[model samples]
Target: MQVRLEQVTKTFAGSKNTQATAVKELDVTIASGKLVGLLGPSGCGKSTTLFMIAGIHDVSEGHIYFGDHDVTALPSDKRGVGIVFQNYALYPHLTVWDNIAFPLLNAKEMKKRLKQRFAELSPPMANFKAYIQRLVEEAAKLVELTAYLDRKPAELSGGQQQRVAIARAIVKNPSILLLDEPLSNLDARLRVQTRDEIKRIQKQTGITTVFVTHDQDEALSICDEVIILKDGVLQQQGPPQEVYDHPANQFVAEFLGSPQINLVGGSIKANKLYLGNEEWFALPESLSDQPVNIGVRYENIRPDRENRKQAFEATVTSIARTGGTSTVQVRLADGQPMRLHRDSDDVLQEGDRVRLYARPRTVYIFNAEGEKILQC
Candidate 1:
């Protein structure tokens, strides 16, 4: 289903008679049958947004819609949204078939009794049995749990149990599926395996899904679009590659990268950029001669052995080799530390002075207030 949120906000009473806003005026639209990720650090309100969308938490202000239906005031069970949590929430004593059939049974039983009470309805009770059986079988096959139909939750591995939880949710055939850090409990290898499986299943089922996670790599790898939050506010939202390539602000630029982007303090005098008491590069005419932070990726920097331009002389303080590539920690002339990646055959020893040059286009300039300033 296509989900829409209009100025949604949630607040909770905090200690010392203050109020904490969990989600602040968030407005977003999730297209039908797409996997969208809510990514941010802990306490950034990703979980709160997911809960609001699932109708588990009430919105303090604004509205939510599923297609043309306004479901902002609907209760959790009435919203037709399925949620799978990190804990899986599987019953250890119940077999896979029972677990998957539980929701269908409850829904059918409720509908059956309601139909029985209506005097105008003379339909036979036998008609519902076939429908329920077909739904259960389809759900089991969707999650690939048909072979383990009779197995209990305890008899299955972590990944298998998670699939059971998914099957249970899918049996209801919810219009939207909410996943809250579902892969956090799995091991490294299992996490990767399950992540790929989730992508495959999502494609096959074509259900609109909202996945919440604090792991940037996980979100970037699987999600078609990503919404980043900071301090309960929407910081950035865009395609994964677009956001990674052009961050809206410093927080976003710093949060999305693996090794973290490097920031060096520098001043713009006249038209020249100065760093470490040395003139580096010429700034664009629109920069207006102000102090700025230069952001550069580790891989964009190259260590020079000769004929370096605007090089900051540094000594190798430490080296870390991780198979194919190595990270070299260098101490600048100003005593600041910076990390650079190298794949050169000639390795530099500790305490060896070397010159480093950064590519011009790879440099990102941020003003004093931490907002990115793009060079035209």
Candidate 2:
């Protein structure tokens, strides 16, 4: 199913009669059978938006559609959306099979499905138990939990319990799947493993999936497209690499990268861009003089051990190495701090003087209002 939110706004009543808008006129579309991520920092209203789509929270304004069907007023149970939460809300006393079969046993839904099944089959399809059992088995197999089907939730590992939750959510064959930070509770390695499994399952099922997460790495790794939000407003939405490469604004550029993008004060004067007092690049003549923020990815910066009287110079403050990569923290000549990516094998020490330069084409320039003004 293709999910669309058109001008969807969600508001909550605050103390003293004030209203807090969780989402503001959000308009976005999730293509059918694609895994899309709703990514942002905490309190950015990603979860609120997910809940509104699931119909757990009503929209304060606008409409939500499943394909062409307007479902703005539908309840959670009526939306045909399966949500797996961060906590993996599995029933403690239930075995994996029972948990996976829980949604299949819903009185109203089961009755409707059984009625349709009987209508479709000759002799009324009497073996209903086998049908539910087959569904449970298939769901368990999809999540790789077949061996643990008879075990209770507490008897399983955290990853196993999470898989059980996922199996439960999908057993009903929902039109859309919603995942709310489903890997947040796992250890680092397990998080990676489970997220990959999630992507695989999503592909096999071909269900329209919306995943809400604060982790940039997870979103970039698993999603077909990512919608970035900040302060209840849509910042940018695109394929992760595209958004990372061509950020729509300062917030999108700063929020999407690891170690964050290096930001420094700059200005344009006489069609020339200056970083600190060093002239960097020439802008179009039609552009007026104005202050700007220059953003450079750590990878774009080259740190040279020999200063060579370059236009920009810095002193290495510290170096942090993880695995084979290194991050060099440096203080510029004008006392501004910056980070650069360097080879772990390179010899460097604290307080070492280094010259800095970024690829001109990779730098991003943003104006006073945080709008991206130029990319060079």
Which candidate tops TM-score? 2
lDDT of each: 0.84, 0.88
TM-score for each of the candidates: 0.90, 0.95
Question: How would you encode candidate 2's per-residue C-alpha lDDT over 113-165 as one tens digit per residue?
Answer: 74577467664455777767877999999999999999999999888898999
| Residue-wise C-alpha lDDT for candidate 1, range 195-288, written one tens digit per residue | 8888888999999999999999889999989999998888888899998888888888889887888877777778788775678888656467
Question: Which one is best on lDDT?
Answer: 2
Clashes of each: 0, 2
lDDT of 1: 0.84
Model 1 TM: 0.90
Error of 1 at 263 (Å): 1.9
Candidate 2 to truth, TM: 0.95
